[model samples]
Target: MTYGEFWVHYLRAHQRTGTRALHYTGSVLALALVAAAAISGDWWLLPAAVVVGYGLAWIGHFAVEGNRPATFGHPVWSLVSDYRMLLLWLTGRLGPHLVRAAEER
Candidate 1:
């Protein structure tokens, strides 16, 4: 699927507010972890960041949403979409995207 198609599927998979919140939490924590790793010179936190971030996201997918992750199909796009979703959310621009995605479903 193209990136646009995957985005629609991605948003559909993350329809629940709980799932999105978990993703937001994970995304923030991951960013903080990377920052900590850089500032502390402890490279271990890098991998830990990946685990922590994706782990929370996975937990949301399995425990909360009961769905497979879009990551399994499109890792690179999924990664970019995660951060893009976060930024759009931060800027109050996510609702329209979500609405559009919902319409597509």
Candidate 2:
């Protein structure tokens, strides 16, 4: 799917508050790992970021959303959308996206 289309579906998949929280937590942890890697010169933290971030997100998709992750088909776009979603959430602009997704559903 195109980025726009995928974004809509991604928002829908993350409708649950718990799922969003988990994603936010995971994204933050990923960022922290990257920073730690840079500071400590431990390159392993880079892979850890991917694992921790995607691991939490997948858990939300499976246990909370009961759906497959968008990453399955669009890995790059899914990663981009994950940061976009996290940014929106951090800026308190996610409600409108969620509303739009729900309307489409």
Candidate 3:
């Protein structure tokens, strides 16, 4: 699927509070890793961060959230969505989606 399509689904999957938390943690991991890589000038640290961060997130999705991660099907888009959701959460807009979903349910 195109990244755009995957983004839509990714956002939907993240509507849940727990799922959003996982995304936030993953974003923080990725950002921290990148920052470390930049500061230490160790390129390899970037990949390590990506793996560790995403690994924790996938585990959270499966074990805690009881859902398959969209990353399995759309890695790039999932990453983009992770950042987008992170921004939304940080900006206090994430709850709107949750509220809307709850209303639908």
TM-score of each: 0.96, 0.95, 0.79
lDDT of each: 0.92, 0.91, 0.76
Tens digit per residue, CA lDDT, model 3, 1-105 = 776556566666665566667667877988998999999999999899888778878877887777889878877777777887788779988777556645654
TM-score-based ranking: 1, 2, 3
Per residue, candidate 1 scores C-alpha lDDT tens digits across 6-76 of 88999999988889898999999999999999999999999999998899999999989999988898888
Cα lDDT of model 2 by residue, 66-103, tens digit: 88988899899888988999999889998999999889
Q: What TM-score, to 2 decimals, does candidate 3 have?
A: 0.79
Please report, as a residue range, the 10-residue window in candidate 3 with the lowest summed lDDT.
96-105
Residue 20 error, candidate 3, Å? 2.2
Off by over 4 Å in 2: none
Clashing pairs in 1: none
* Ten-residue stretch with the least lDDT total in model 2: 1-10
Better of 2 and 3 by TM-score: 2
